[model samples]
Target chain A: MHAYANPARFLRIARWLMPALLAGGIVFAGGALAWGLFYAPAERLQGETVRIIYLHVPSAWLGMLGWGGIAAASFAEIVWRHPLAGVAARAIAVPGAVFTAICLATGSLWGRPAWGTWWVWDGRLTSMLVLLLLYAGYIALAAAAAASGANRRVAAVFGLVGAVNIPIIHYSVIWWNTLHQPPSLSLSGSSMAPGFMWPLLGSTLGFTLLFGAVVLMRMRMLLAGAQADSRLRRKALSAGEAA
Target chain B: MLKPKHQRMVLLAAALTALLAAVLIAAWALRHQASYFYVPSEIKAHPPEADRSVRLGGMVRRGSVHNEADGVTVDFIVSDGRADVPVRFAGIRPALFVEGSGVVAEGHMVQGRFEADNLLAKHDEKYVPREMAGMTAEQARQTVAQTK
Candidate 1:
């Protein structure tokens, strides 16, 4: 991890890796979506509405994974002061929020048919909404810190503090009697049939790859911006000396 | 005194522990509020005040669903394997609303019958292909009965 703290080295690796991930993501996500949408049979209860699970589950997973990444990056930023840690955390915020929003939207769509409502204030739904809000707050706080030249640690600390909500979101169904169903997949096994589970897994992997590609793309852009800012500062310093 | 690096780690650890503790305490306090609905067993064990509106959630009792003469009102019993609450709702039910499934109704008790103003269906976690779920109605009823 420390070895890649050097920006140039990180950029060199990411250049090739980004496109590779993007291509793999497209292939897998496309194939999985095709399979899920057309090939997989309708669920016993939910019928065609269950097809939404292919998109919904992956977005929900990635949304949570994004925050988890931010929290880990925040930890590194605070403790080790890894130079790229802040960049990684900042890069994750927007995509994470996007995925969270997607999760909520797809969930609302699924609920309208299967659960008979577009939205409910159940434990699962509410906690996920809170996660989205946390993502928004993190993005805004990070931006404000950047603009004001304030300590980035403030945003980093917020990232770490907000991580407590992750567990709450995970356990909300078990902890409370909710309108939302409990997890279909767990460490023990899946409640879903092979016809559904395989494509769902494929879709999850595809989306995860896509998420990684997007985050890397954002990190590279942020790093380039930082480099430009520093170069401008240096040029100004030299011109002032000459004057 | 610890080195700055160690100091930061210790501080982060302490801060995280404190945050987790605070959240745990808050969740413990808000457990009842956090739960979206109460089961029939809970209602039977400790009924709420007459005027307070609360959500009641449980399985729709098999063979208990009845359509009233008014055509809008429907009567059913919600069961949680331990207790049962008879509910009456006068509204359009959802597409998934059926006997032997799960439902959540929001209203208050009036003369031992729950008068529900809103209803939302709940679903189970199982997701088998429709072809594989060609169980006879008797089999479906038995499954619900056994689960209940």
Candidate 2:
């Protein structure tokens, strides 16, 4: 991992990994969706509408996972000052926000049939909403920092501080008597049957890989931009010396 | 030259505006699709349009539940004293849904049947020291009320 910390080495490997990740993501996502949308039996209680769970649950999981990624990247940037960490953290922001929004929207869709209301201010929902806000805040801060050449360390500190909410969001359902259901899948046990579990697991893996691929691509772009800036600065300095 | 600080603020404002617009559009599109709550009596008096999806809420009438061979779908009746509406639901019933308790059913009215795609049972109103066994509506309401 330390060896790959160097941006040049990371880019070399990332270039090779990109196509494979993208292909795997498409295949797994497509297969899981097909199975979930068509092959799986309609829930006896929810009928066809229960299909929304395929999209909704995965998106929610990814939203949480994305934040975890941001937290990890932030830690690297702050503690190790790994040059690529800030770029990776910024890259994840938009996708994290998008996934969070998808989770909310699809959850609302599922809620109409299951809960009678499209929106609820329950503990689980509220915490998840806050998680979304954190993503937005991180993105806004990074953009702001970019303009003034604000220290990446400052952004990293904010990232670490914001990460405190991740655990709260995860355990909100357990700690509170709320309408939202508790975790269906956990290391201890899963309420879902094996048949349902397979597709869910497949979808989660696919989504994670997709997130990794996107983040790496965005990091590459950032690295390229930095290189260009350095070259232009060097050229201007040389011209001044010549003058 | 535009100050970098001002440039950042402008970009932030623009991004926020765009996000707000997208959210508003989605909310508007889904407004009509939003589900409404209805008691059994309301459903019987003024049934929803054939294709309109709505929720029915009330006590599950005693002796009105019959489980099918599949053990998943159950035919039951929801009642509000004045009226009882027959409902069909397929899936694992909520732990709370039981005879003589509040339930909410979501689906459409098709061919004189309130075909429920989902069913959720409301817990009792009393504060029972221990969780009670079986789906008992009266007990649930009693427990909930007691707790309150």
Where in model 2 is the C-alpha error above 4 Å? B1-148
Q: lDDT for model 2, please.
A: 0.73
Clashing pairs in 1: none
> What C-alpha lDDT values do all the predictions have?
0.92, 0.73
Model 1: per-residue Cα lDDT over B1-148, one tens digit each: 8999899999889989999999988987888889999999998888888899999999999999999999999999999999999999999998778888899999998878889999999988878678768776567546645744
DockQ of each: 0.57, 0.04
Give the total clashing residue pairs for model 1: 0
What is the Cα-based lDDT of residue B103 in candidate 2?
A: 82
Q: Considering every candidate listed, which one attains the maximal DockQ?
A: 1
Report the Cα RMSD per candidate.
3.8, 13.0
- Candidate 2, after superposition: displacement of residue A85 in Å? 1.2
